[model samples]
Target: MIQVENLHHRFLEIEYLRIGEGHTAIIGPNGSGKTTFLKLCAGIELPERGTVTISGKEPRAVNTGWVGEVPDNNLVFRTVADEVASALRFGRVRADEIKPAACAVLSEMGISHLSSRATHTLSGGEKVLVACAAALALPPEILILDETDTHLDRKAAENLETMIQRRPAPCVLQCTQDMDTASRADRVIYFEHGHPRYIGTPEETFSHLYNTEMYPSLWRIAGCI
Candidate 1:
């Protein structure tokens, strides 16, 4: 379980919130605290007032993986294979197992052909996929993504979405403005000005916003009137 109480960061304030294990999509306009909320959950940013905890421990204390808007920021190694293996190596997995492990993940992500390519040479979509693969190498208990779809083409987005659905991570949190992507999640959190305006299933949340221009694109994606 993820819990936040009396959480305050920047211009946002969330008094109490609890999230159970599952895929959750966070949606909001720009600067609505969506990214900040995810970052706090990922332990990327510490809250000033309240506490953010994942499974009873601070987010930083847990085994967590995150991929943000900037894919290149997540890439630390020069090559695809090396980048994917970096996480496992840091976790102290056996050296002999690293190569096969990295290869396996890359293959699973359908990027096996790029394993030998230099990381800097990959396209925007490819870089995002590789970064995601690297995060999965850690096999984290929780995974967080911030607007990663912006970098991906349709096919690449579909591929990554499929992997996210299949991964066994107990908690998957993403911040996105894409209604199509948000609709696929088990739960949706809608934010405005750093506060959650709605929290429910995708259908329920979209239905509530159907009459407002707040989500013009979402209505079409959800087939809502």
Candidate 2:
């Protein structure tokens, strides 16, 4: 479980919020604090006030896997294999075990063919997948995707979604504008003006957003409203 109380950082503020284990989609207009909230959860930025904890520990104490909107930002190494192994190296997973572990995750992601390639030479979609592979190689306790699908095509997005649904992490937080994608989450958080205005299951959350563009098109086709 993730807990937040009196969260205040820059433009974001939350009196209290609790997020349980599962995939949770966060949706809202631009500058609504979606990314800020994820950053806090990922321990990338400290809240100026209050506390944020995961599974009873401070977020910084937990291992976190993060894939941001820009694929290049998540990647640091010059080569594919090294990039995937970077997380393991940082986590001090034993020298001899790193290569095999990276190889295993690349195979799992079906991108082993790109193992020897230079990271800068890959296309945007490929880079995103590589970033995803690196994050999952750690198999972190918290997985945060900050508009990661923005860099992926339809098929790639579907592939990533499949990987996510397999429970790579106990709690997965994705901030996305894709209503269809958000609609599939186990829970939904709708933010507006730096506050979460709605939080519940997809059906319950969407019920509050039916009249807005945030409503999933698939739901409309199914006559859910």
Candidate 3:
């Protein structure tokens, strides 16, 4: 669970909010404090005032994995396999165990074929997948996806979504512009300005946003939009 109380940051202000475990989607217009809230949750930025906690612990105290809008920015290794093993190496895992661990993680993510490829040789979508595999390799308790599908095509985006839904992490926070993807979440948070205007199941939240572009396409075909 993630708990926020009287949170205040550069562009975010929330008196209180609690998000339970499972996948939760964060959606809002551009510059609506969505990313700011994500950063706070990821422990990348401390709140100016108030508090944010995950499972009753500060986010910084928990192991967190993150992937952002730009995949290229996430890669710092020469090869995909090395990228996946980077976290393990940083954590001082046995040198001999690195390759097998990296291989296993890549296989689990269905990207074993790309393991030997150079990071610079990968396509944008491939880079995102490699980055995602790297983040998942160390098994974080908190996994954050910050518009990671922004650059993916339909097929790649769907593939990424499948990976997200099947994630090993108990808590997943995804901030995305894709309403279809947002609608698939267990919970939907609708943010406006710097506040979460609505937070509930997708059915409940989308009802409040019926006339808006935020309405999911699935609902549109079903006439809920």
Which candidate number maximizes lDDT?
Answer: 2
Q: Estimate every model's Cα lDDT from 0 to 1.
A: 0.87, 0.91, 0.88
Model 2 scores a TM of 0.96
How would you encode candidate 1's per-residue C-alpha lDDT over 121-151 as one tens digit per residue?
Answer: 9998899999998888768899998999899
Q: What stretches of model 1 exceed 4 Å from their correct place?
A: 213-225
Q: How does candidate 1 fare on TM-score? A: 0.94
How much is 53 displaced in model 1, in angstroms?
0.2
Per-residue lDDT of candidate 2, residues 72-158 (tens digit): 788899999999999999989999999999998888777899999999999988998999989988779999999989888888899
Query: What's the lDDT for residue 55 in model 1?
Result: 95
What's model 3's lDDT at 12? Answer: 90
In terms of TM-score, the best-performing candidate is: 2
Question: What is every candidate's alpha-carbon RMSD to the true fold?
Answer: 1.7, 1.2, 1.6
Candidate 2 stretches with Cα past 4 Å from truth are none
Q: What lDDT does model 1 reach? A: 0.87
Give TM-scores for every candidate, taking all chains together and pairing residue i with residue i.
0.94, 0.96, 0.93
